[model samples]
Target: METLKLKKLSFSARLFTRAVAALSVMIFMAACGNKGGDSAPPNTLLGITNCATCATSIPSATAIDVFSAKNATGLAQFANMQLIVSATMFTPGASSAYNLYTGPVAVQGQFIAGTTLVDPAATYGYGNSCTIPAGTYVMQSSTVGQMSLGMLQLPELISTTGVVIRMRVDQGMLYKDATTQQTRMYGSVYITSVNGVPCSSSFSDVFN
Candidate 1:
């Protein structure tokens, strides 16, 4: 009887130990430190067309630290080492070719969609791998040619005049993320103005 009792106690101890270990693993996997909600928000709408080097989607809240979301922190280095971005808008029927712009951008603070009423579809895009900082970042298009304007002849169109052939992020992450960085949000890149004249440019298939 004594031997049987000892065995039963030992088995219970082992079972408890295993349960504790499993709980610890679960905690680590979630890794949602103080960052707000229980999990990331639904803003996964992203389409990247011109990566040129990297071919992986952005890390998920579960895979990487959601807290990593910040302003254009390390964008310059990211643009140089990470991916290049391209954003395009279609022109009217039979009149204009695809209005395309490309560049590498950085921002501080991670951006979540719907958080800001400004852009809800996450139509905007960005590129690069460094931490984002709070400020503006510019990406220049290496290729810009007009099918009609005799190519290169009208440099001003794509030049500094209105800053065409470029993608710019004026303080990415329009809305600030929770200090905890727990909630995931969506974002999009739409041109606010063009040709020295502020114009709302609609965008499609924006790649970051």
Candidate 2:
């Protein structure tokens, strides 16, 4: 009877020790697996241009704001990244056009080019612009063309003299995980009129 009792006591002690060890391992892994949200680097700016036909050169004194958004499951929500530009323009409105390119931007606070992870669908037009999640992205123009004169309305006129033109660009970032993938829309590059002068601005969607 004494021998049997000793064996039972030893078995219980070992079981308890194993349980404690397993719990400790689980806690350590949980800490290691944690990852905070993505972040952007410093000194980033959103660029714009004014190429209206007869509008005065975009005042070098003008200022513009840039913002970012993210979409985790559904739509875009406002993000922390923001960019500003003091002035942007180009010589010979017809020849060069007022060009504004945002400052060098990066994600993960590292400022690396082409390092931003993006969804393949967002870049190819298969995904919606309002559904991108939080991540770093690169912006570039994809197409430029003239709009039909008939499409211009007095209220919609960007310039009274300059021909109405349009430029479409692919803008956003993509991210992928081991089991899932997501794409988020940051903003769109669209032509707008600044004081009835043709110009461009980038706007972001609000993620919810």
Candidate 3:
């Protein structure tokens, strides 16, 4: 009777230990899973799921044309010119992980160059990468061109003034090992409108 009682107590102890171990594993997985929703607002209508790069705030926003650069001469003088940009997106990290990224997430956009400013004898080359500080900018275009980030494609973006996008831009140096550092820019983007419709209230379904 004594031996049987000892065996039963030992089996129960082992079972309890296994249960605790399984629970710990489950908790760890949940912690590492997609926790994007924690930072998002309640009942928010967002088109992108698991949006790791959602903009919390847009401090500085402006419309930029290729002609804005002093070196980009003849761009405004020419018609039907194309302006393309290869941009990477980063989620503004928390205090603990400032300036760090989960991985490389990038987007590309093609625009019909605007012909508003004409600098005949303008200087060449991007003078400084810091000319345009880290902020939100709208790449103004004459026509609605295609913009894509991974599988998400925004085919039609229409506006009278061609306010196609509002993207967060940050400057960095590429080819760190090279003698001269090259400027690289990347950031998150938000499509504020589509087909001349604002993305709010009644036209909100367009985003979905």
Worst 10 residues of 3 by lDDT: 1-10
Q: How much is 173 displaced in model 3, in angstroms?
A: 11
Question: If the candidates were sorted by their TM-score against the true structure, best first, what order would they fall in?
Answer: 2, 1, 3
Q: Which regions of candidate 3 are displaced past 4 Å?
A: 1-100, 104-162, 165-179, 185-208
The C-alpha stretches of model 1 lying farther than 4 A from their native spots are: 1-32, 35-45, 56-165, 169-208
Candidate 2: tens digits of C-alpha lDDT, residues 1-208: 0000111112257545643453444334333432432222245432333223212322342222222333333322333333222244322221101112322211111111122223233344543321222333333111121111101111111211223222232223222121211111222223332223333132221121
Better of 2 and 3 by TM-score: 2
Best by lDDT: 2
Q: What is the lDDT of residue 94 in candidate 1?
A: 26
Q: Give model 3's TM-score versus the native structure.
A: 0.17
lDDT of 1 by residue, 1-208 (tens): 0000111112257545643453343244234333233333224322223222212222220111121222222221112111122222222232111112112221122222211111111223322211112233333222321211101111111122222322232211111123332322211233333333332233211112
- For candidate 2, the 10 contiguous residues with the lowest summed lDDT are 1-10
lDDT of 3 at 116: 26
